[model samples]
Target: MTAGEDISVRRKKLRYRAWHRGTREMDLVLGPFADAHVESYDHAALDRLEALMSEEDPPLLKWVMGQETPPDNVDLAFLELVIADHHARLAK
Candidate 1:
């Protein structure tokens, strides 16, 4: 499938599962990360994440959920944290 098609399919699946609505601010910070490297596993998500990361330093989860920017290097790490948290929540 084309990139557009792939994005559409993935977006639909994510939305359907309510995956994008992350239960916490940290989850929100990590949602893009998991979406990039884990769940839907799209490289484009990673690219977008990389771009986001490059913009600023790490912010609090609250800030992230509030749409505050994060530093470039921390984006992946941030997402990893969120993904792990998400899994832990699921396991509970």
Candidate 2:
């Protein structure tokens, strides 16, 4: 992000990107997580998430949904949080 970008502006853009990942499933997997966390995410966690976002959707979605095991580099802890948050949203 540019130095001029406000934190809220940056967070809004990140949320949009998360919701607009190339497929609907990916959008649902990540969009709400970004909405809930981006504003509060520290740079390191946000960087890790951004790196994960660059990964292909199929494998990443599978990892999030627990269909396929993620490689060691994938952040399972964070993915679990996303999954839990998604489930909670669904339960509401």
Candidate 3:
């Protein structure tokens, strides 16, 4: 969090970033995921979401879409949750 930036503001910014990831595919996947989860996120969860958002669109999209494995440095557990959430949404 930035100096004096409220948690709610941070979450709102995260949601905006998730929905505007410079790729339509990323936007579609992450936007809804953020909508469903971001509000309830604690600081650590928000940081994880921010970290995922920091990646470049191409590789991030591939990872999220299950077309490529994310790097060892990436957060696999969180990524799995994202993938699972996306799949769950698709099944709905």
lDDT of 1 by residue, 1-92 (tens): 99878776665554333333435544344554445554454666645544443332335453444455444555565555554665565566
lDDT of candidates 1 onward, in order: 0.50, 0.82, 0.89
lDDT of 3 by residue, 1-92 (tens): 66446888998899998998898988988999999999889999989988888889999889988789899989898888888999998899
Residue 79 C-alpha lDDT in model 3: 85
Best by lDDT: 3
lDDT of 2 by residue, 1-92 (tens): 66436665766777899999999999987898898889887677777678778889999888777789989887777777877888898899
Worst 10 residues of 3 by lDDT: 1-10
Error of 3 at 31 (Å): 0.5
TM-score per candidate, chains pooled:
0.27, 0.82, 0.91
- Please report the TM-score between candidate 3 and the true structure: 0.91
In the order shown, what is each candidate's alpha-carbon RMSD?
10.6, 2.2, 2.3
Model 1 error, position 24 (Å):
17
Clashing pairs in 2: none
